[model samples]
Target chain A: MLPGMTTRGYHHGDLRRALLDAAVQAIEESGPAALSLRDLARRAGVSHAAPAHHFGDKAGLLTALAVEGYDRLADELGGAGDDLLEVGVAYVRFAVDHRAHFEVMFQPDLYRGDDAEVRAARDRAHAVLRGGLAALPAAAPDRDALAAWSIVHGFATLWLAGALPPEAGRDPEQTARAVIRRLFE
Target chain B: MLPGMTTRGYHHGDLRRALLDAAVQAIEESGPAALSLRDLARRAGVSHAAPAHHFGDKAGLLTALAVEGYDRLADELGGAGDDLLEVGVAYVRFAVDHRAHFEVMFQPDLYRGDDAEVRAARDRAHAVLRGGLAALPAAAPDRDALAAWSIVHGFATLWLAGALPPEAGRDPEQTARAVIRRLFE
Candidate 1:
């Protein structure tokens, strides 16, 4: 380990948090596909077996990340108030701001998609998104919800992939709002 | 090499096609991130150096895959005719049917997004999508196009991730048509 890079005196929770933070950084640099528990432990300045011990394996670690992602997304969406447009903007913003989490959260093949924590957290986020649809016209609320979700999710995915044309603009939230407006209003 | 696995009598184009076919199968089993030229050659029953000679590296091979993906997508979308709804349904169908290509094409970071072939092929696909929008109302074509792309892309992504709720149903093209109708109707 490098000088000053030590896990000395770190409590259990702090160590876990540090490892998770290191994972996010590593994922941002590479991607979820390249992740390994041993590498995460090395980055966290812990024992080689530390990550595996804590998270069980790479998929386990990614499962934790997905759970955190869904919770954070729920918080962001809930905080955006009950307006569907603003919620859509917030969804895009969350995707841009938390890119690593966003990447891992959507790729279920990379982690334990059936984990109970993930399901509950995902449901929380979904409920918040559903709450936003209350402002839409009552005709076909389920269809409207799917449309709203699809537009924002698509804009975020396209933005992250750099697949959008130049006219799509640099501002994720602004561009997402405009795209989402086509579905409503 | 395994028994019955031989590259004898294979022409240049045939070998390349065989490698690409092997790559698609591998990606379907694992993903783009796990792809390696050596493994593809092994799967194709060619000499270890053959894949390197043909594609240069994993990214090069994936770039070729992305180009092929865009071309295939263009063909599928074009066959949908001038109807935007049909085009959207076609987009989802392409994603479901060509899972490996769809996965690699959208994740631009996995390959050379600026490759001339990729750009040209992607433009062809984009043109088909744009053509479908001619059926939409004339208020804001550009915004409408973005919305149309987002909805279809998003639905396809969610379907692949298994992120959509149970109510979304299992039939991709059918579900996509319903989700898309919310935007224009």
Candidate 2:
């Protein structure tokens, strides 16, 4: 919201977006498991009940994050063009850049995986991934998709964990492109 | 230990191991972030102070888990012989069978990453992974290793998260083998 343009009590659609943005920041700093709806409300400069009204509770908030994450991922992967290599690189980049959302989206325990919005968004993201793989020749198409998904997901997860050795160095995306290209060989 | 082999007040070396084992179960059920040392001590049927004595705090216990996880990973990967394919398969197997350890091992923030024991074990594990990649030809061998690591790691992570399509079916190892073989192809 613009700094001084809003009335104190005026409700706007921007509140939800602002609250979700606050959630991403909070989850990034404190992790998904420690996220608090009350704190997010405080961060958003709203009444304690404001976030709960929009999200119902913590799980509800996380469910929204997962859905939003998948939608954003679908956008990124969809925009990566038709090349499987570039698509794979884009997937890793999305995970690294949206670390908090990526974490919640995958860990079903963190949110309701069966939520209608979550399931729909997840399917959309999966479709984008499979669409990118259409250019590749494979002994088994299904298994190939799994392979592509696994390697990129693993790299991003490892990179986030700091489990990968420092050898990859400085920039995750460039190093990821070099690493991801090996699958084609 | 067998149910019948019981003794009261026995201070065997097993206390730490037993506590660590309990931690694995707790972590698997809840998560690393929700881990409680006091609760672990209770589950292990020890004094409340027992867990703290052995681990200092929750981070201390997680640090122990990280060390043990890296050591175990090294053992599995090292024992897979010179074939990098088998080593990758073994890596996924380790993640599935020891899900808790695998989860904590990657997330550096969950424990003390800079501790001497953790750094050494991490190096040993890294050495095992790099050793497995030695059999492959690549434009860049080090990045190839990272690629190899990322794929298997990503697959296992996806599988654990239940993020993979149901097509993966009831058997993770079988599905994982097929996907992992693609890296070699």
Which 10 successive residues of model 2 chain A have the least lDDT summed? A2-11
Query: Which stretch of 10 consecutive residues in model 1 chain B shows the poorest summed lDDT?
Result: B1-10
| Tens-place lDDT digits, model 2, residues B49-137 | 88898889988999999999999999999999878888888998999999999989887887899999999998998888888887777
Model 2: residues >4 Å from true position, as ranges? A1-10, B1-8
- Measured by DockQ, the strongest candidate is 2
Instruction: Tell me the tens digit of each residue's lDDT in model 2 across A1-185.
Output: 65533344444668888899999999898788888888998898888898888889989999999999999999999999878888988998999999989989988887888999988988998999999999987678888888888888888898888767668897888888887777787
TM-score of each prediction = 0.95, 0.92
Model 2's alpha-carbon lDDT is 0.86
Q: What DockQ does each prediction reach against the true complex? A: 0.75, 0.78
User: Could you give the CAPRI-style class of model 2?
Assistant: medium
Query: What are the RMSD figures for all models against the true structure?
Result: 3.3, 3.5
lDDT per residue for candidate 1 within B1-185, as digits (tens), equals 54433456577787889999999999999888888887887898889998888888888999999999999999999999999999999999999999999999988988999999999999999999999999767687777888899999999999998899988887888889989988767
Q: List the residue pairs that clash in candidate 2.
A: A151-B151, A154-B154
Q: Is the docking of candidate 1 incorrect, acceptable, medium or high quality?
A: medium
Candidate 1: give the clashing pairs.
none
lDDT of 1 by residue, A1-185 (tens): 54434456567777889999999999998889988888898898889888887899999999999999999999999999999999999999999999999999999999998999999999999999999999777688777788889889988998998999988888888888888888765
